[model samples]
Target: MSDMLSIEQREQAWVFTLNRPEKMNALAPELVLALTEGIQAAHQQKIPLMIFKGNGKNFCAGFDFSDLDTASEGDLLQRIIQIEIMLDLLATSPSMTIALCHGRNFGAGVDIIAACKHRIAAAGTSFRFPGIKFGLILGTRRFQNIVGTQNALEILSSTRTFDAQEAQKIAFMQEIREPEQWPSLIEQAEQNNAILSDVTRRNLYKVLYCSAESDQNLAALVRSASAPGLKDRIRAYLKPN
Candidate 1:
């Protein structure tokens, strides 16, 4: 119901669309809360498949820094914490999760795609994980688990932008698909979801999900983001020479 996110049910899947195209669907606090609530609802309703997409040019641009000048460091840290919690929930969700990523995605936006079971990106989509540039460790562990330690280091260390092809090569993306091919992808996922009963599927996810390190991941993010001059680091990262 929140304007920041549009939710719709199609057959057995629930689609949650990020609706802030003007801002590249950045994860503003309100939008993050809306998405968290929507994910929770999908879990409660036992939806078999949960799909995430965005409207307009890009999937998501990452954390909203529009109000950085006015926000204290503590406020920014809390926002990052909330985003991590939401991502943990999505990553460990019982239902099958899919992300349809396109255009340019950065920071926590890339984290969202990383959390999903099925990560499909448009042909020319690109991603950058620049949280480290600001001394933030958000999603590093999960990303490493997805793309391996060496690849993660190379990508995150440089904070460089990589295209969808490179993403698939690194195993960060499961497939490179055009937007028009997405409907069939959804249908395939729906069919796959129907293969298992709700309880069985939930059990399977519980068995397969490696969340034992989630707490540690959160702690690391907190420690890094809580370091002194958090705002200064962010500002420097934003306005590079």
Candidate 2:
């Protein structure tokens, strides 16, 4: 509903496009809430597939730090928690999900891509998960599940920027695709979805996805983020010498 996120029913899928291109589609509070609501609606409507893509140069820049200076630590923590909730919804959704990423993505942006069933990126797209650098454990379990514990630890500890090729190599990204080829990918996904009834597909997802960790993930995030001086830690990470 918010201008920050555009939701459209395209063929058999609900396309949720990040609409704030100027800010690299960062997940501001409003944008996060909008995304959460959209996913909820998609679940309720039994949409067969959901696609997440950005409108501009990048998919998402991660958690918006534009308002950090004016925002209190409590406000920042709440925002982070909201993002985690949205990610959990995407991760557990019965509908097939795809994240079409491009440009540079960071922090929670990469987390969003990790949540989806299909993670695709443009050739030059890159990603970084800097939450650990700020002493926040957001999306750690999910990342490990996608890329394995050792790979996740190596990447997170170093806070390194990895290109799309490397992401696909480690299975962080399911495929590296050019923007022009995304339509075909979507078509293929639709075809795959059509093979099963909605109830059958939902049951399949239930058995395949281990959502038992959702509560633990949320708790870990809260504990890390609730530690004293969250804002200070973020500020230092943002302006490292």
Candidate 3:
């Protein structure tokens, strides 16, 4: 729809590219909405696979703070809800999803990859979950599902940056690709999807993402992130240290 995202349908796959190169493909609300719409349409069309990638040097830098800086608490909560809904759709959609991440993947960017069934990162790509710095609990459960409880705690608590190798070692990233190898790997994925039947695709998704226990952490996150003093904490975190 908007230039914020580019949606294309190939023979076997629907590809959604985040197009905000100037902003490092940041997740502005409109960009999020465009992506969500693309994913929804793919599901409706029964597309076998959907690919999420960024057009810039970086995959994503996370949520655009420009809008949040002036948002009221009520407005902020609504935005968070919208993000949660979009991510949930991505995570649980019947269509298989892949995330191709490169460069800086921070905050909500990391969460986006974690939601995908398949995650491939470029060499030298770095990821960080800086929500602790903002006094928010975004994607805690999904990160836990990717890397488990102990790893998630250590990674989130330290608020330290990690590279693609470390992410793979933790099983957070399923594959790491060199710059030259991306095209072949993506082509292979497309070829593989070409032969997969809808029944098999649905079964694969169910086996992979739906087998997990019903997650209560999302609800807990909503309460924790919306509690009193969050705005104050965010202000403090954003201030020059």
Candidate 4:
């Protein structure tokens, strides 16, 4: 396991903790690879439940854009690809994926939680889809699949931050719990995993992902990512006037 993440195999679940509290658990290349590897390992072992949580005040503040000004276009593209891979992995893994969200879940952080099969969050948690604000198209279809298409459009089209309660109403956050109640809720979920079969779970995801328009959706994302002035727009957003 990489230093960026803590991986633990428990009796009822496999836990993956993002260990970058200092960065508000921002997504980094190493951290992303570590997460991907951890999830892949869980799938290989046929782990029934996988829990993702961040060891910090916030679940995640989104991608580590600290180096955006110096990063080349190739570097930016690679980062986006890695994020896509992780989101896809989480979505399609045979293991039942859960995201325990809190605080700042913005940009790609929103995508991560959206990709999970289950989402639970503490009160006061905040979420935003800032890709549109930065001229990027990311996790649009997945977000649409999680919430309805109209809700997804509403959230993505505006960069305003939404609270956990609002997220629950929209079905983006399935459950909202107090900090103290999180443990019991997670335990309950893990204990209930015994009733679910790995094959059934995997096939369910397969059917959900392999849609007739899957290729078309991906093509749209690719086209948007390659759109002219995208780099400049992202840079401008990150570095504001």
Q: Could you say which candidate leads in lDDT? A: 1
Where model 1 places Cα greater than 4 Å from the true spot, the runs are none
Judged by lDDT against the true structure, how good is candidate 2? 0.93
Query: Tens-digit lDDT track for model 1 on 202-229?
Result: 8888988877978998999999999999
Worst lDDT window (10 residues) for model 1?
205-214
Question: TM-score rank, highest first?
Answer: 1, 2, 3, 4
Output the worst ten-in-a-row residue range by lDDT, candidate 4: 209-218
Clashes of 2: 0
Deviation from truth (RMSD, Å), model 3: 1.8
lDDT of the candidates, in the order given: 0.93, 0.93, 0.83, 0.82
Candidate 4, residues 143-192, lDDT tens digits: the string is: 88878988888878988888998889988888888768877877898877
lDDT of 1: 0.93
Q: Which of the two, 3 or 4, has more lDDT? A: 3
Q: Against the true structure, what is every candidate's RMSD? A: 0.9, 1.0, 1.8, 1.8
TM-score per candidate, in order? Answer: 0.98, 0.97, 0.93, 0.92
Runs of candidate 2 with Cα error greater than 4 angstroms are: none
By TM-score, is 2 or 4 better? 2
lDDT of 3 by residue, 23-69 (tens): 99988889988888888888888888888889979888887777656
